[model samples]
Target: MKLDKELVRDVLLAVEAHDEPDRWLAIKIPGKSDIEVSYHIMLLAEAGMLKADDVGSHDGFEWVPTRLTYKGHEFLETVRDPEIWRRTKEGAEKAGIAGLGMLVELGKAYGKQLLKERLGIDLP
Candidate 1:
């Protein structure tokens, strides 16, 4: 399955809101199947954004995220706002940069721009 950063962000938000541990539940993301969500969860775990347990039964393994890590929380904070996320994604796409790290940096820059605009104070 292809990596969807939006989905990743959504999942992180959900996990952050839940604030629980060891509870594996299905999260609903529009246009994404359960398997796809599971795949994204696995990716998040691999990215060190979440801690998950591989619970496989006779059928298959299910990835269950226990909680968000420090990095995950940081990333979520960077992309939580809808406008910031949209701008960050657009800037990254325009620049042809498609890495997670780069996207985070772009989001940070966009967030700072938004803050500067909101406060009308030039940020050095």
Candidate 2:
């Protein structure tokens, strides 16, 4: 399965939105298949974005998301802004940069731009 940026964002948001810190989250996105969501959840855990438990069974793979790691929070913060996320995706597509590393870099660049424009706090 291809990397779905939108789904990645949604999963991150869902993890972040879970209010109960101590309980495991059941992240279900409407219209998204269980496997697809499950795959991305695994990817996030592998990428150090989320702290989760790998509960792979005979049926298939699954995870119980606990919370976001520091890296996860950093990336989420960068892409949480709609405009920044939009610009990051657009720029990535235009430049043919599909890797998550590039996406995060692009997002950070746009996030810095947003801070400069909105709060006049320039970042080097």
Candidate 3:
């Protein structure tokens, strides 16, 4: 599946912050729209990279916690490939999104395995 780089990034951000129970980790990622974030979740599910656990719910919305499948982790590694890295860097350069620097920092914070868990695209 050709997951958008932006969406993949958001998924990784959210899964890494899985420890936080109050809100979504993707929300912390800079400048992402609501649709983009939600789409990442859907894509992850559709790709079978992310598994939804019935963590129950509050109010009308179900509170499902997503866990990374082994395949998902593998996929994330692909995201870190040199090719993808170059694309990411070029895109960031073109957009002048200094926030991408923060993503760089996040990549370091979460480690390589976390990336696979969140994005479902593996890195080289």
Estimate TM-scores for all models. 0.83, 0.90, 0.45
The residue pairs in collision within model 2 are none
Best by TM-score: 2
> lDDT per residue, candidate 1, 11-66, as tens digits?
88888887466676557778988778888888889878889877757897578787
Stretches of candidate 1 off by over 4 Å are 57-61, 121-124
Candidate with best lDDT: 2
Report, for all candidates in order, the number of backbone clashes: 0, 0, 16
CA deviation > 4 Å runs, candidate 2 = none
Of 1 and 2, which scores higher on lDDT?
2
Model 1 clashing residue pairs (backbone): none
Q: How do the residues 23-76 of candidate 2 rate in per-residue lDDT, one tens digit apiece?
A: 788889988887788888888888889888878799777887888889989999
Model 1's alpha-carbon lDDT is: 0.82
Listing every candidate in turn, what is its Cα RMSD in Å to the true structure after a full C-alpha superposition? 2.1, 1.5, 10.7
Task: Go through the candidates in order and give each one's C-alpha lDDT.
Answer: 0.82, 0.88, 0.53
